[model samples]
Every structure is written in structure tokens, then in C-alpha cells.
Target: MRPQLHLTAPQNWMNDPNGLIYYQGMYHIFYQHFPYTCEWGTMHWGHAVSRDLIHYEHLPIALYPSKYYDRNGCFSGSAIEYQGKMYLYYTAIRYAKENPEYIHVQYSDDDLIASQAVVISEDGYHFDNRDCKHLVVDVIKDQNLGDVRHTRDPKVWIGHDGYIYMVVGSKVSNGCGYDGEVLFYKSEDGVHFTYQNRFIDSSIGDMWECPDILTIDKQDYMIFSPENIDVAPRPNSNAVIMPVAFDEKTCSLTKLDTYMYLDYGLDFYAPQTFVDEYKNRVMFGWLRMRKPVEGENWCGMLTMPRVLTQKGGHIYQQVHPHIQKLFNQKTNTIDFDEPFLMRISMLENEDVFLGGLHLYIQDDCLWCNREAISIHEDKVCNLTHTPPLNQRYDLEIYYDGQVFEIFINDGYYVLSQIVYKIIKEQTKIKNIELYKLSKIQ
Candidate 1:
């Protein structure tokens, strides 16, 4: 089913969001895409833009596999504006020469070498990846600092000390296997970069991807994706948010607080954030899917842009104000006949069933169980939760037929997931404000 309020690719496969930024009065989102099929393949950067962050227009591909250094794929990265130009930095993949038969769906340690590069666009809509692309970091020569095949996903920004700083997801040898870490790079200019130091933590899993650093309420935090780590109640790769201490002079990061799952749902990963026009750190993430929904050619969707805030050392994600404006028309009941939004309050032990999805409050936690719909034989689909809740809490739910984005207690906790269909709903919320969301044109 086509989503009513979320951003999906024009067609085919899309994964991690790349090069998210607000530039020249427009919000540009570049994503990792494989255009020819509904399944993942050789990666290319697909482009889209919106003036108000609610409605988007698709553009031509921004970056692809062209040069020898990046012939295999153009992977995930971030965007920044420098000197009247937009600088898009991404990981460039080049497999070994003997691996001519390499398939992207298969994983092999000996199959690839990864590096970093940047492409500059004078105008936000136009990109010249062939002639303008420059190699900024080479993994082949810096193998001591990171694993040659795993170093990627460069997130760059200017520091308070007036130096261009970068954090790239990397892996360093721990004798038996590799441990995830982040490599810091210092640059006088945005293009030329030198490796300064690396940040390593034992809890950071086997490898990390899509590393992002942002300050909220004067506190720094790192957002990233890690593989092979088991978060409680879930046993796969997931997005993580952790409070950190960044040293501007040394260009390094130190962990300050424990990490938490960014979204407590199955279909979220590789999120990246950008400073919006309003100066809020807004984020978007790939709502991952195993396949196209039966007949559709597109297989992925993006979460509604979330404005992040911090309180008591924990990050909270609220729906962007532009999204709030779309649901201005008020209604009376919650229905899936079309997209809708609802705000309600529930006390402890209260349970509500919206067709196949089950929401309940128990054990001081708000839980969303969706096993009754869209069952997968290999994986359990009912594993969604929020952080511990108070005796009473408010919820804001945006239901777009097949997908749901739930914000708890004004986004102190968020849970986003996809369910195929809800045939019926139970439990009526009294004195609640339910609104019919405006359809995207």
C-alpha cells in the first residue's frame, strides 16, 4: 500500500538516507537507492527536495558508481554547505580486481575496499560527480586505523574551533575479531582531511555505520547503527543514541551516558540528522522492508522528520511542525479509511486494540504488539516498545493505513512500524482530538 504521509522512493529499492541538509531555501534528501529492481543491488544516490518539508519532488540521481575508486557503489553520507557550495561526502566502494563476479547481496571480507570522497554542487539541484569528485580519505593506506573493507559513512561538520571535522564509521582489530569505532579527521579546508584520532568503545558491537554527531541543549550525542550487538529484547542491528563528550581541540569524542535505541521498532535504521531552517536538529530514517508490499515496486519509506530535544540526558524526538500542520482538520473517531492523527491519554494497565495492532500499558512500559498482522515466519513482528512510562501518559499517533508513528508523552519515546492492514479497531478514547490528515499532493 502507498503511504499517505511518509516519503518513499519514486520506485525500486532505497536504504539509508544520505546527504540530508537544508540548502538554498530547500530541504534536500539524498538516499541510497538501487533503481533497476525492488531488491538491493549496486547503490546510487537518489535525490528529492521540498520547500516546506511536507511535500517533496523527486530529482535526478545525485551520485552513482562512476570513477574507479567508487565503481562498486556510492554509499551513505552527510551534506554540508561550504563557501557558497554544497559539499556532499560519501563512502566510495571499490571491490578487489579479482572479484569481478562479486554480488552485492553476498557478503565476503575479501571482496571490497572502502574509502571516502566528496562531490560539490554549485546549485542544490545540480551535481557533477565525474569531474568534480575528489578523494578525501583512502583506506588502503590507512589500514592501521580502520579495517579496509569496513571504513565508511562519513559525517562532516564545522567545529566550534573553526576546523572542519569528520567522523567516519570504522573498525579496528581487537586480535580475535574487529570492534566498531569512529575515526576523526581534521581539515583546514572542507576537502583536504587528515586523520586525527579514533574513538573506540567495547559496547559498540562489531561494526558501526552512519555515524552522526549533534548537540541538543548544549549536550553532545552520537547517533549510529551497529551490527552483531544484541539490545535487550531484540537480537539484530539497530539504531542507537548515546550522550557523549566532544573535545574540540583534539577532535575526539568520549562517552558520557549509556546508549538507548532510537526507535523501538523493527523497521528503522541508518538515521541521519540536519540543522533545519528553524535551527532545530531534524532527523529522518529508512523504514526498512524485506520486500515490496506484494505488488508495489518500491520497498522502503522514510520516517517523518523528527525535531530532537534533550531533557535529563535523554534525547526525545517530536514530529516536525510542518507535519503537525498537515493534520489540522479535526475529526471524532480513529479510522484507517484514510490517514489520520489522534491524541489521547491512558492510565496504567489500559489496553487499546486498533484492529490487528495491540497497544497496552503494563509493567511501567507502553507496548505495541503487532503480531496479529503481517506475520513473518523467521522474525517476530510484535517487538515494539517505549521507555518506561509514568502512571499516566499522553500519546500522539499518526496512522497512514499501513504504517504508524507513535509518540509517547510528547515524544519522550517513539515507536514506528508497519502493519499490513487493520480490519477492525477496539477501545474508544473519550474527549480526544482526532483529525483527518491532509493527503500529500
Candidate 2:
């Protein structure tokens, strides 16, 4: 039950996407990988390349726990093209207990300290961790500024002001407890960085992870995963996007008042974006699995790349054109047992049912329910409610046999679910366009 439209590890475990960039001629995607089992273990950076985003070619492991600073694991980070070389920045992890022999045998836990590090590749494919690893940011010694173990996930980029800017997520150690904040840094060259101020909000969450910065249509936005948020109902964590203003000289971000969830789905988290070859802002996210498959060798998968834009401070996402080209084989009916893509135009008081999933319009809002699916009982959450639809309801749905991704009104809202088995199906009045999707190998 692997995904063909989305990317997964060649075999074992995979998590948050790391080092996503379009460099040289191919687009590269590096991810957090554990090679031993289907479960999480010590981390390494798995590498893959694709000329077109639909198909991929797996490469060697890019970064591993080689140096003393990152001996425990190599956590998540980003990549950039600097001076004709590929600079890959990542969070290097080291544990308090000294057990070098069991690094690959044990799963990472709370007894770890993290620092930011970099590895350069003269070419896009070769990464020599033994000789190329350099520790750029050391572990914090002062507990008042940030938690020593939780400061990590360096996202580096070259700003329009001709300087390299980096954002690392952390938990600020307040007198009472901790607050979520993002640490900023600046550099003339990509190697060495100087500390700058941080952006914090007491109401955001207790901690943040995998912070990303991007500018769309002259507007700046920060995307991050907030942990242990003070909310009635939540998943393991949540991904949010907020509009912000950046100071190039000070390397700081000013957060705006309102923020929105990046995805209203139970299986989405840790989204990272990069500029495509055509300069389109593209995003990829980890589909967080609530429970591991009983006998499968792989555990996690990524979401389909979404092209992003903004209007009135709200981010809009849509399926990439490259993915749309694969669904050229049109059909009159869709089979839930196979991979397929379907689009429908929904009207007020209209309800559409595809297999076990249901979509309906109620009180001018778009709603989705997956409670009828067999895997609904195994999920963290199974219902989605969108804000007012303004009477426009165009829906696009993709089912890769194991996962179902629904896009409402060209991505104004999205809900993704994992469906193991489709029990029943009932279709309403339909003017539908259904197509078969090509396999990705």
C-alpha cells in the first residue's frame, strides 16, 4: 500500500522532508530516514533527484551521523545553491549518554543536544560527510535564551539584500517555563553566521519545529509546526502559515496578528517549499501516519507538490501543472480500488459521495467526513469543516489507493485522509470528469 503520486523511502522509515531545492538541472529532495526498520530510529538524510517532479531517481545517503557533533543523528534542514556549490544545512544531534556503538541500533529520544551544521557538494549528487561537514552554530550554553536540546532545524536562504538568512526554531526558556520562538541569524558568506533577534508569541505554542520562510507576490510568510499548543483538539502537532514582515538589516521577522492552518487534514505536517525551475513556489509535506502498517517495510510518505500563491494574506495552494498532465486518460466512472483523479462542480445543498468519503454543502460551508471509511477508527481525526465558501464549490480529488487528497475550489481548502478500505459508494447527481493516473516508478 505505497503511494505512486507521492514520494516515500526506498524501503524503511521516512519523515519530515529536508534539503528541498532545485539545483543545477534536477530537483532534489532529501528526507529524514531510518534504514534499519519500519519504525523510527537514528536519523540520516536520504537523497533523490528528479528532472520532472512526477518521477524520481534515488541516490546515495546525503548526510549521516559521522562527525562528533552530529554523532547521534542528522536532523532536518534545508539546501541552497551558493557560488556554484550546493550547501546543505541541517540540525546535528548529539546525545548526553556516550554510546557510539548503538547509534544505529537505538531510536532517538529526549537525551539529545542539537546544533546547526553544513555540508557542501561540489556537484549536486556527491556529498562527502566525512570531509565536508562543518559546525556553523554550536549548542547553546545559556539556558535563559533557549532550551539546549530543542534548538534545531536550520532553514537558510539568500535574501534580496544579498545576504544569507537562517531561521531556527526553539523553545525560549522563560522564568516560569518555555515559549515558542524562532531564532534568526545572518551571514555574508554561507559558512559563518552571527546571531540576531528572535520572533516569539506566547499564544502560538510551547515549542516550534521546522520553521520555513518564503516570499510570495512581495509578501513574506513564515511556516512552522507548533508543538503542545493550548487548544481543545489537536494532532501530534500542527502546521501554520502567518504573514510577516522581515528586516533585512536586523535579520528579524515581525509576525502579523492572524494565522491559518497550512492544511486542514489529519495526516499533514512539516511542510517545506522551494522555488521550482520556473520560479514557482512549490511545497512538499510529510503525511503523518497515526499507526504503522502491520507488515509493511515503509512507514511514511509525502504529499503531492502544491504551487502556492497569496491573496489578502491568505495562502492558496493548487496541484502543479505537471501532475495535472498525468491524468489525461478520461473516464466516465471511477474505481475506488485503483488510483484515480476526479473533479466535480458542487452546488448549494449538493452532496457528493465517493466510496466511503463524503462531501456536502451545509449552511454555506464545505464539509468533509471520513467516518464511513474502514481506517477512520484508526485516525487521529476524521472530520473537516471549512469556512464560508461564498457559493463557489469546485472540487478536485485524488486517491492513490491508500491516501485521498481533496481540494476545494482550487485549493482554497484541502483535506487529506488515509483510507485503507472503501466499504460502500453512493453517487449523487453528477457532472463529473474522472481520469486514470499514471504510475510513478
Candidate 3:
């Protein structure tokens, strides 16, 4: 079967996807999935893959919490292809009796296409929990790796310094403020790692879940999603992507100037990357909304993977251009220069909120309305001016796909919202007027 993803299985949980490994022409993606209902409970690793990362097929559950170490739930982690074999390192959990979390390592050699491999690892070799399901670094423990609630999502990457490094999502000493950072460590061998630095810490969001690093043409990029829920109107999923540069001088990481949306639409996060057969840096953003629409059974899905590019130190992600063919519907050319009404027909209603209009002056202008961002917020931003580019913004309205996202000024500012089940065609939105336009690219 060319595996397909359905709505979130009846459940209360599912946040991050951990192990993303590409092998022998096949990309294996495992995520945190809960079989129960909309709220988050017993977690398992949901599996899926694709050759092109465009069309995906979902396989059965991959790693269950059936073992003692992972009896509670299996959390986030990452995958690496080292020494001709595939290895997975993830966080396994427990509730009360022994709630402390730890890392679990597993590997595979012979037959590949597996839903769940019982042949885990002992020293990461074909046996489950050979020691304690975790490879702990004793000397590094004093770094004050606080919180018994710690441990989940380990991201490994090879650095420019000719050594492999891994960053785990961890809290700071004493759990003082809301500080979550990507703890760095170095290792000659992919298995036993040595502590490095704080990598990068914003101390901003509630808890940092998945931390994955990507380097393109010599520049390093760190990607992560926070558990912060401060949306206007209501709260939903909070997925953010920031630019991080590694400072060779201090051997640390620094945040770049701007921040962009991971996925402007709903249900998106836990992104992981890999250089495909063509060696192009590609990423997969899981499209699993924290809160599914009212009656929708499934709560999770993954977006078509995208390619990453950097210009002038800024990183931009575009749906791998090849998938443009997936639009499937032929586009219609329409024009509505000057102010006009969309859905809201009446003259007064169609009117732009005057000076409220904002312009994405350049082809790559990115601005954020912190006030406009919160978990489950119903936000409506009105713009009175068109972009500097005189071209009308051609939009693809996936209405029947009740999900609503607005990409204005050539996708400069993405505005996405959740619209309840209503008549798709009768969106009431008809004329889309252009108040102004610019020639800027």
C-alpha cells in the first residue's frame, strides 16, 4: 500500500515526531502518536515514509510503550545512518512509580521495511535495553541537567570541525525560569557522546520539544518547536523556526536576526531534515494540529516535505518546487484592481480598515505580530494596501479543505486559521480587491 495518513486516531495526545532517518532510497519517519483521543496519553512512534517526500504512506505503529522502560510512552528522538546500518535514539517514558525519562537506542541491519522492530539494541546492537536503554554520560550530569520530567527528542549532526555532535532538548539547572535549550555534546563514535555547550538557549517558551540541526553550504541552522500556548482568541499549536548560526570563536550557537513561521497553516511541526539522493537539503514538517477540528477523527498528518535555501544569511523554505505539479487544479486568471469585496459583499463591509494596511515591501520581508500569535487564536488581520509588487496575489483556496491560511505579498506574511465545517463553495467571500500594488520582488 502507498500508505496514506487519515485523521488523528481517536486521542488526547501527540506533539513531536522524533526519529527521521532516510535509508536505501526510502525515507522512514517516526512521530509521537497517541491512539486514544484529542488530549495526549499513551504515546507510541507512528511510522510513515515516501521516496519523493511528496506523497506519503503511513505504516502501522512502529515503537510501542510495551517494554518496561517505555511503559508509559515513547517520546521524541532522532535517527542516523552510520557505518552502513540504521540507528534510532529516542526518549522512553513512565508515569508515577518511576516517572524519570531516559534515552532508548535501537538499530537494524538485514531486512528493512519494518513497522516495529523487536530487535532493539543492547549497546545499540540488535538487543533491547542491553544495559538500561540509555547511554548516560556520568561526567556531564553535573552540568545541572535539571527536571525529572526531562529527556525527549535527541538530534544528532556532524559539525564542520570534523566531529559528530548531538543536541538534546533539555531544561536548565534547578528549572529556574522557563528555560529550555538544545544541550550540545560531541562524540567520535555516534553512540557514546561527550558534553559540549548550551548550544543555544532562549529561555522563552514553556518547554522545548524537538531540536534538529541542518547545515547548508557551510551555514548551520537549528530548528525547534515550543510548548508555549499564547494565541489570541484561543490557543492551538505553536510552531516556530528561528535562524541559528554557529560561532566558531566560542564554539556556541547564536540566533539570527529574524524569525519565520514553520507552517503558516494549522497542524504543522516537529520538523526533521535529510539530504536526499540528489543531496538537496530537504525537511519534513509534521502537520498534526494540537486540537483537531470538532468532528474530525484523525488529529495528525505531515506536510509535503520542502527544500531549504539561504540567501544573505536568511533561511527560506519553499515547498519542494517539484510538488507544484500537485496543485492538480488549473489556475484561473482574475483581476480586481482598486478596493473590492471578498465574501463580504456590501460596500462598507468590503472596505479595508484604512491605515491598518501593511506592506511586505520586499520579496523577502518577514514581520511578526507577537500580538497576533497565540496557540488557538482566531485572528483576522485586515490589510488596506497591496504589496509593492503590482501583481495580484494568486491564492489557492483549499476551502473544501476547511483549513484556512492566507499567504499575502508572495507568501511574505502567512495568516492561517481554522474555519468550522461550513459550505466550502459558499464562502460568502467573493471579490478580492487590491488596494495597492508594488513592483518590488
Candidate 4:
């Protein structure tokens, strides 16, 4: 079952939200899309726009693999408005005709990929490569830049210093082994980027992808999904947040010892953020499914937009205010057969046990046990720990079709998953209030 409100490609495979920006009174979102199949293949930048975050209209394919520099695919990147023009900085991928030695020798010639390019648009809808030369940044052979094969996913932003800064994900060889590093670049104009330095080298993972920098309350935070991390209870790919302090004069980042997981869930990754007209740091992520839906034509979805804030040395995420307008107040009890929004909280001086496929808290953790309704052999259940609650705990759940999004304590922690089962029995929750979602036009 596809989502009713969450943004998904009309058809085919989609992943990694790219080139997110708000310009000219519209929110433009581009993503990694494969139009021909339900499986991953040649990637193109799929386009969509929304006047409000909740209602989206799919636009034409934004960027295709046409140029020699990006003939293979138009990979993930970010967008920025410069001089009344919107510029998209993307990793243009083209397979090498011959295998590069730095890449593993076992890889086939067709498997070798290179990332390099930028495109521009005047009206925020139409984009072309003619404005600037394609492949603005070429693959580097320098040992310090690490394995060129792993470099990609360019995220660019205009800094407080009024210079455009770009962070490209790459792997660095530190003699003994390769580690993930984010290479930094600067430009006075949107084009002609100059390599400044590598911003971060982390021992947490071997490669980093989808690097993003968010400046919150004068603190620069670097966020990325690292691959090959051996941490227990971690997904194959997970997003991490590193607190960094940036020096505009020198254009460098000093990473603090503190870092944390962006989301403690299985389905969240490759998030991109944009500053809204309200000056809020809004974020969205590709909600990754571990396995394909049995009968679906489309294969990916994005999480609901969240506003991010930092306080007391912790990052806080809350649902964007725009989304609350979609809540229908006609009902207070959920109808299991249809899409609904449910808010639950513990009763005063009361302990309650929710039954029949409902979420509940236990031992300082939020748990979802769907074994009662699950059709698959593998149990559909998960738990994420949160700070101990002295009183009632708050949870908001949005059930749209087969997907369920759980926001705990006003989004301090979130859990999103797809469940295929239909509840056959009545479920009860403490002080629950249910509302239907307004139908999307």
C-alpha cells in the first residue's frame, strides 16, 4: 500500500532527496529516480514542487544523464539560489571505460563511477547544463583525497561569509586503511569551486555519503550517512550528527567530541535540509524499506518534513507546523480501515496497557509489536529508548495506508515503518485522540 500524504514518485524507483530549496514562494524537491523500473537503475533527478509541504505536484524529470560528464546518471546533490538564479550542484556519474586502479580491481569496467557536475535554472523548474561548464569538479587522484571511486553526493550552501561552500563525500586513505572524509570547496560565484580542505575524517565508518551542513544557533553541525559502520544495533546505513564550529575567515570546521545518531530508526537515511521562509531548519529523509513491497510499482518514500533545533546539547526534531493543518477533527476514535492520525498520552496517575497492534512505552523505551497482525514470517516490531518520563509520555502516530509514522515526545525520537497487516480486533490506547487526514487534491 502506498502512502496517501507522504511524497513518493508517481511510479518507479526513488531514493535520496536531492536539491531541496525554497525559492520564489515554492518548495522544490528533487530526488534520485529511475523511471523505467521498480528497481534501481540509471538515475535521473525527479522533480516535484509544493506550495505547502503537505501537498505536492510532481513535475517533469529535472536532470537526465545526457551530457558526457553525467551520461551514466545524475546523482544526489543540493540546490542554492544565487543572483536570482537557482543552481543545482549534483554528482554527475559516468562509468569509466577502463577500471581505475584505486578502485577495487575486481570491479567491472561498467561498475566504475565518477561524480562531477552542476546545472542551473532561472525559473526554478527548468534546468540546463549550458549556463556553466559541466563537471565543475573533476575526480582527484591525490592520495589525500582518498579513493576517487567513493567520492560523490555534493551538498552546497552559501555560508554567513557570503561565499558558497560545498561539501563532497569521499573516502580518505590514512596509510593503514581508508576512512570517510568530507572534502570542502569554496566559490565566489556558483561555478568555479576551489578546494579548501577536508572538513572531517571519522573513524566511525569507511565511507560517507550525502554530506550536509546545518548552522543552528551559531553552531555548525555536519550530518551524513556512513557506510560499513560496525556499531551494534545500527542499520546498514545510518545518519550521524557531528557538532562543529566553523571559522568563516579560514573556512574550516573544528569538530567537537560530541556526536549522535540523527534518527534511531531503521528506515531513515540520506536526509537533506533547507531553511524555510520562516527561517526554520527543515529536514527530510528517504524512508528506506529493507525489502520491496510485494506488489508495489513505486519503491521509496520520504519522511514527513521536520523542523530541527538544538538545545541543552541535544538535537530536537518536531513536525513542521504546516502539516498540522491537514489534521481532520471530525473523529476522536481511529477507524482501522482508513487513514488516520492518533495522539496518545498516559492518564494522570494511571498505568495503561495498550492492546492489539498499538504502540506503548515500557522500561524507558517506545515499542511497536505488530506480531498480532503481521503477515510476514519476520515479526514487525521495534523499540527505541528515550529519556525516562516522570509523568505521562506523549506520542503521535500517523497511519497512512500501509505505513506508520510514530513521533515520540513531540519528535524527540521517531520511528517509521511499513506494516502490511490489517487489524481485525479493536485496539485501545490511553487518552487517545484520532483524526482523519484531509484528502490530497
> How big is the positional error of residue 369 in model 1, measured in Å on the Cα after superposition?
1.3
Clashes of each: 1, 0, 35, 0
For candidate 2, the TM-score is 0.93
Distance (Å) between predicted and true CA of 208, model 4? 1.3
lDDT per residue as tens, model 3, 6-93:
2222344555655666676777767777766665556677766666555456676666666555666666777766666556666655
Query: Which candidate, 2 or 3, would have the higher lDDT against the true structure?
Result: 2
Model 4, range 174-272, lDDT digits (tens) per residue?
777778888888888878888887764656687888988888987789888888764444455677788888776676778886667676555578999
lDDT tens per residue, model 2, 1-441: 677778988988899999999998899999999877777778999999999888898998988889999987999999999999999999998888756666554334457788999999999799998999898988987776777889989999998888998999999867777789999988888889888888888888878999998899999899999887634444757888889998777877888657777777657888999999999999999987655566677778889899998877678898888997888888876766667888888888888887867888988887777777635333367777677889998888898857888888878878787765575446453898899876544
Give the alpha carbon lDDT tens digit for every residue of 1-441 in model 1.
688668889999999999999988989999999998988887999999998888789999999888998988998899989888999999999777544464554355666689899999899788897799999998655556788888899999988777889999887778888789999898988889988888998677889989998899999899999887665446478899999998878877899878888888757899999999999999999888777777687888889899999888778899899888889888776667788888878778887767677788888888888877755644434666776786657889888857888888888878887876575754445657788977666
TM-score per candidate, chains pooled: 0.94, 0.93, 0.68, 0.88
* lDDT ranking, best first: 1, 2, 4, 3
Index of the highest-TM-score prediction? 1
lDDT, residue 181, candidate 4: 82
Off by over 4 Å in 1: 97-110, 140-144, 231-235, 377-380, 425-431, 439-441
